[model samples]
Target: MAKEKPGDDKSPIAGTQSLDRALEMLITIAASPQPGMTLAACSAVLQHSKATTHRVLRTLVARDFLSYDDDLQVYSLGVANLRLGSEYLRRIDLRRVALPAMRELVAETRDTAHLATISGSDVIYIEVVDSPEPVRIFSRVGDAVPAFATAVGKAILAWTSADTLDERLPETLVARTANTITSRSLLIDNLALARERGFAVDNMENREGIRGCAAPIFDHNDTVIGAVSIAGPAAKVPEQNDSALGKSVVATAQAISALLGASPDAATALPR
Candidate 1:
């Protein structure tokens, strides 16, 4: 006899085999490189008979989770999937989803990790994970800083639309510190670099003797919703270590984005 495969519904669970197969089918179709999957292609990928695959596909189509195109003989995700995704995104708490990763980032870097969102021309700190070291950066949860002078703000700004950027960015950027970029042209150049490197840095621009590295966080819709940042004294977060810390911040931001249902392609997409 042929050996039964995993998720074949022969185990202790009474009727999960069909459900497992259906979910797998949905994932396979969603991940397909083409716009949709032919019945034969679906069956081949699932390693199941055409009849069984057709039945599962029919059930999904009936439930509106998948759509079948007669002309193309293909199956693709339907409106129901979009509704489900929208509902899931509506209920997600950004700070709560990001706290664990922020904590982990602080542990690794020994610097304060902050979760912040854009509020007009300011960046508001919604959540913070403090460093464990004796002398570390301190930040209040509700503190707001100028979006033009901070790493987190620059990170988010790098991915914002041109129209939004024009609205958020002022005609004249006031210097918060001597290191802050006062020229609009220079700041724009800095944002461009941040977008290219996938992260941003503040070399004592936001506050004297403080430095930060940050990366933008994208949502399921590939929107720049917020940013994750690590900040500490300039002595500890030196320029040489910016690359390493930037990588950690980017990873943590990506993890939070995954939890928010962002697709793999979301990370690489630029502003619309």
Candidate 2:
């Protein structure tokens, strides 16, 4: 006889039990169309005894993670589940929809560009377009620095709720450079300015000797998706383009917005 594998018989059973116990019944009910499924259906999907499945689902209903409508006696997704899933889907969509626009920005700027979306206290870099310049700045996909510290980050934060802003950064600061804003009050004033101007400039706040300019990207829903930024050496970028660099950066972001079905306001907000 072959040697018995360690816990082989019991391991799979344990895993199945844990999953069955965890599936919220009310949620399952809410997810079903026509308001409910028969007891037989639940057993078929979970491959468990009807009694065990019913027990788990009833518990979920009691906790408000799910609900049972007696008259309809059918299940559908709960509002809470919808809300949670919606936020996730929104960001995923943001990434897909912004790609075309960021590509266009890169084409026009001839410098590196990025599409950034806010994540918690930081602005996450979702995509980047590399600089054609021989000596260039290279930022990979999915790299995020603090939003309070970068041009693109500030552009997105400027439109975010103030309460969310306070939670991410205090009035004091996390200094990344000697030029970093150490004063909370000053940063707050700058945020207000960004709100008024519809754009933000990093001015070497995050990295010394590097300058960055950014403008926010908006969706058809009027929600801010992220920002597009042009960053390079301060000496080279500003001197080479005069004010045209800033103008073009802003224009690129606006063009991205138009692609995403933004309002006509995008025309005026981001200009060449």
Candidate 3:
């Protein structure tokens, strides 16, 4: 007979359904496009009764994971989330390792440089080095962008395992802009190109007037831990120079990977 899992009912310590539900609610709230969510709104979308959802929200608010505006009756992520994010970054050493290369990339390209990692189905920015130029893309450290619509996201996804890709990608990709890829087949083709070229391009797909090129960053074990990108106004990032910029991003990523102790051979052999 097969061995029982640790969390089975017969185990010494059983799983907690309420904890699972609370985490699910937290994820839903975190992913909301809007700044805050009302109790009714969260309950409606989560399919949970008002009383149950409210109880979880109250607990989260008390713990500083969520913030509540009593007057507005709205809730949003709180300072505790920021602390957690900081802790995560510190633990991974990604920010510390990527910042120098990111700054150099910005100086070389005169464009905004970003470092991001996958979180659930989204790409979360952990570090950003703004361009010295007057007009540049303004993105925050904790901002989350759709993985299927950004160059950094595509570069990371191209090297992700097939099973993980299926889990991360949605059935229908969200259309962030007119140029966004809505079909999975087309996305696969794009990934193939990224894999072959060792870089990816957004081409103003995530936002109008913005274009980005990116390459993946690997860890000591050759795992793709994140990506680094160069972003700027579409007019400034022309298709004619995309190849050159792609090479620059790929080289920067490789340098960072080396700092993280990844073998050059292992990094180059990353699977698509």
Using lDDT as the measure, the top candidate is 1
lDDT of each: 0.92, 0.71, 0.88
Candidate rank order under lDDT: 1, 3, 2
Candidate 1: residue 178 lDDT (0-100): 94
Clashes of 3: 0
On TM-score, the leading prediction is 1
Model 1 residue 172 lDDT score: 78
> For model 2, what is the C-alpha lDDT against the true structure?
0.71
Q: Compute each candidate's TM-score over C-alphas.
A: 0.89, 0.60, 0.66
lDDT for each residue of candidate 2 in 92-178, tens digit (9 for 90 to 100): 566676667667766776677878988877888888878777876778898978888888888877776666677767445789888
How accurate locally is residue 183 in candidate 2, as Cα lDDT from 0 to 100?
Answer: 80
Report the C-alpha lDDT of model 3 over 1-272, residue by residue, as the tens digit.
Answer: 98976657532334676887778888888888666899999999989999999999999999999998888788988899889866654576788878988899988999999999999788999999999999888999999989999999999899898889998797779899999999999999999899888999999999999998999998767888899999999989988889999999999999999877677864457464
Better of 2 and 3 by TM-score: 3
| Candidate 2: regions farther than 4 A off | 1-92, 239-242, 266-272
Candidate 1 per-residue C-alpha lDDT over 1-272 given as tens digits, one digit per residue, 9 for 90 to 100: 98987868544466678998999999999988767999999999999999999999999999999999999899999899999988988999999999999999998998999999999999999999999999998899999999989999999898998899998887779898999999988888999999888999999999999999999898878898999999999999999999999999999999999999777667578774
Clashing pairs in 1: none
